[model samples]
Target chain A: MREPVPEKTFIGIPASDGIAIGPAFCYIPAELTIPVCAAGTVDEEMTRFDMACKRARVELQSLYEAIEKRAGKEEASIFEAHQEMLSDPALEGKVRAEVEIGETVEQALVKATKELASLLAGMDNELFAARALDVKDVGHRILRILLGLPDTALSAVTETSIIIAEDLTPSDTASLDPKLTLGFITAQGGLTSHSAILARTLGLPAIVGMGAGLLEKVPSGTSIILDGRTGEMIFAPGGETIARYKQIKAKRESHLLSLKAAVEKDAHTANGRRVEVTANVGEAASARDAMEHGAEGIGLLRTEFLYLEDTQPPSEEKQYHIYREIFAVMSGRPVIVRTLDIGGDKPPSYFPFPNEMNPFLGWRAIRISLDEPELFKTQLRAILRAAVGHHARIMFPMVSDLDELRRAREIVEVVKRGLEVASVEFAGDVPVGIMVETPAAAVLVDVLAEASDFFSLGTNDLTQYTMAVDRGNAKVSGLFQPLHPAVLRLIRQTIDAGHAKGKWVGMCGELAGMTKAIPILLGFGLDEFSMNPRAIPEAKYLIGKLTDEKARDIAGQAMSFGTAAEIETYMKGVLALL
Target chain B: MAEATIQVKHKIGLHARPASLFVQTANKFSSKIKVRNLTAKVDFVDAKSIIMVLTLGVMKDHEVLIQTDGVDADTALGALTSLIKNNFGET
Candidate 1:
């Protein structure tokens, strides 16, 4: 058996602001159920109902007064709403009328609870329906307290007592001491729910959907950590996790201090080479985010997302208009547009293709284009039509063999003919490229480089295929090593082959953002590394510190690792040095 | 005038969304459209009464007669033939 919690304990996503340490104890106000004395006189029963109402009002008003005095006018606004709900005219009238008709105070409370629940539930809004449960819970609590029964409110015990419950209504939240309650736990809440939004606004660490039996395992006053980003929980965290976290926290503070200095300066490496940090977006609406995030230009403009919202093919004019918007935001900086890589995992339901035994390795991406010649021709023509007088480097996906590459070129030629006949003002040199995802394509890069102007290594699929492990399959998921020697070898070979054939190569994958892999990729002499926008600053931070010479040394060391854990430890040491 | 009884080669019959799209294509042409599931000649474009087409829900390899008469009836027959043969992208 585990030792009793000496300190108050809480494990949750931290929300609400400020930090205060206090004695660990949970205040479980017992379920308020009044005993039914049915044989009492009618006037006596009415007296009992009035007594209950008086007691509830006094307790509620005391809460309102305390919040108003302590939190001031603005902070106390939430309590005013809660106070209104508690003292609602219809609510008091239901209890009073029930007692007059020979019902005991206990019976009157039960009746009022049901009627209130029904009235609220009848409303169409979910918030209203949810409150139907809340009022009933609160009413039950009040009745139990009147009957002098033990506590019922789930005491969220933290390093002291953090309350864990199915749910806590706003009224329940209003009544609790903000200092005593560390965080909240519930069965249901999305990232954007009112509870979560409020929690973040307040900075209280909360974890939702821990399932049941959490209170039994983690008693009141257990020290714990709530990791919100990765969704991890520490039951009783050891020294290593604590120490490492402390260091990272210090690093974050330092980074914030540098934000102002970095804001005015362009991103450059330690060795004086400037690296373009651009935002990657799926839609043109996210274009402003690029500018806000200090993006030089969009690195990857995923055009496939546009084709997904509609069943019918988007007309050429529609494609042109969307492309024009993306190009317009950049002003002059280049936007690398990848064509529709459909029919793999993202197969459209409207055009249901027959189920494949192995979809990941089946007819997907460029393979779908090869099969549907007309579909590919239409998209190619649309891109050609859209690429008029704009800087757009086009790319194709899943080029495992020479024939697929040639066939893609042939369709591009078809689209170009249409544009030429239509007298469209287009950039003739909007360089065409192929994605090197398959191991075969990576190995045959020299041959591919001759036909294609550039290569974008899609490492997500390449890493999965190289290790013979499905990224989604948990049994072999650990075996799906992103930094395995086998995967790295392919990347190295592809980059070398592209450089050999007078072609520029870039990577569009998670590996580009990985801090350790960033150095390796930079050392490997990649022309560019495209990643999700958020990863830019951190990747740039590492790249800015790393020298080509140092990166090459790290790459050589990484190849010697016998296991993924060893590689991880080695990378951590490298990061520590930086 | 041209007519032919073509078998519903795709596993799912020409119904629902596929049928809706087929009817939309049919309306674009100046042809009297009728699709028969065996002997029941179903009306092409009444979306409300389209369930009658679903009621006969023809399966793969079942033959259904098509009768069309118009200026481009042959073209309609050819286009409908391709859409049905493609399994509406099932293949």
Candidate 2:
């Protein structure tokens, strides 16, 4: 004689698009506790600590192997470093000294790790601060072993269920079992949080920022239905609501299947106009993934990753090999490699950047390259060397005026001459392009196009600079709209200018993949569209349905709209009709 | 005992992978090595200990005094100085 659980519904932000129906697995992690009494003698405590360290090392080895298989070696290196820390004599020596002084093993270990972690945390560097977290994580893992506590509660999920937690850490998301873990619902986090991004990357249905008291309300094992597309969650739903959701889920799955089936097909409009749908990638693995998803080429290959975590600038040989691997993966498909777009938000560890009041508007991108000619030349030399027998092109980021472009081109000429003097083999006919991101660059596209081989509209920065809104700041984020009439006008102007100069125009921004923005960009006669690999199939499918004449009409109407909101609504209405 | 003062020119100083690499290299020879951050003006701690090396807080271009007392002190100093000079083989 059990009372039926009452049906309830909760709304949250839709992070990833999908439908999931499953019982809730309320994940409440067990905290490790230190024993109050010192039960073991000094020698006995030392032995316990030693045994725990040994076990932790074995666990780290396995974790490293698992992570290496799941997410490449670069990520797995963290565990290897943790293993080295566990073997550090100083850490053990500190613990042994504390244990000899009458402190318990757990207490001694905590004190030692805290002291070491604080030393790192006190540094003014963000990378060291992040390492402090790693030190703490390793200490906690050993402490769990010493206390005989089980691993994270996530490992206990044995059945298919929707995970409910306050929030998920990077480690939690990384260890999520794809088969048993259907999706997740979090009481905290925004769309761009680490968990949300990981969920999207893992293709999991997730709804975040569900607010507080969510854990207390939704008990474990309660049958719940969630739509990641609409961000709706139903708890203990009624029969009718369940049926309706089931139908929606079926229809959505079939639609997704159809999109996947047509992934290899070229993007062509109803009026027989063809457009290149490419992908923006950072590394070789992503380039391969993009190719599998039917990316015609790599429109944007961001080169910042090679310089970010290193203790020094990557040498020309190292850069050459890395670029060569990516070129081999792309297999003759054109790759537009953007040279060292560092500074501003992404200052590399090796470089000493001046503290600036306005970093974005200050010395960044091409400015940094032009100032540091040696660093710039090393990268250019690598690109040119790696471009041999590969369809590789070079593109510059954050070009504002003609002076910067002229200097950059002159440097390229210098590098080419230097390579020729050294008898180095390089592709001499590589096309050089400029990213029309700044208002100055967008407005002067005609003049810039004459010097450049092609133009790529970086709408993300275009919107930010044009709207005078910082996209990262929540208060002004609403004004950071790409669909705004002003941003669209800039895009139209840039495309028209590039065409007038007999140069092809491409867009390598988030707007390029958006279903609503595709028709408008098509109407503007953009030659190429580059976006996230996952968005390529749907973008191609949508492009196939729109005629050039109708798309131009829709673009004309969209351009006539006053505000971003009006344009957004109009685009959504237009998308529904197709 | 053999001692030498060398500037740690690695970008991130003695931290993370560099610290681990420094300790691993020091542990190679049968030398009892100790290092102190001359810039930070801290006491010399065991160079073979990653935690001790990290606690020095040696930033880029910070000078560190290394003292090795054992059979292979000169070799250890040469190896350590070369490692620092080469930027921990990160290039």
TM-score of chain A of each: 0.65, 0.69
Q: Give the DockQ of candidate 1.
A: 0.02
Candidate 2 chain A lDDT trough over 10 residues, lowest sum: A124-133
Task: Place model 1 in a CAPRI quality band.
Answer: incorrect
Interface RMSD of each: 21.4, 3.6
lDDT of 2 by residue, A1-578 (tens): 99987888899999888889989999876767787996478999999998999998998888778867876675667678888889888888889989989999999999998988888778765555546656677788889899998667488898999999987755566678988988999997778655676677667899998999999989899999978998989999988888998999898888788688658787788888889999999988899899989898999999998887566899999999989999999999899999988776778877888989989898999999999999999999999999999999999999989888989999999999999999999999999999989999999998887679999999999999999989999999989999998999999999999999899999999999999899899989899999999899998888888899999999999998899899889999999889
Candidate 1 achieves a global lDDT of: 0.65
User: Candidate 1: lDDT of A7?
Assistant: 26
Which residue pairs of candidate 2 clash?
A: none
Cα error of candidate 2 at position A34, Å: 10
Candidate 2 residue lDDT tens string, B5-91: 998877778976788889999989898999998997878999988766877888888999999989999999999988987789754
Best by the lDDT measure: 2
- lDDT of model 2, residue A304: 91
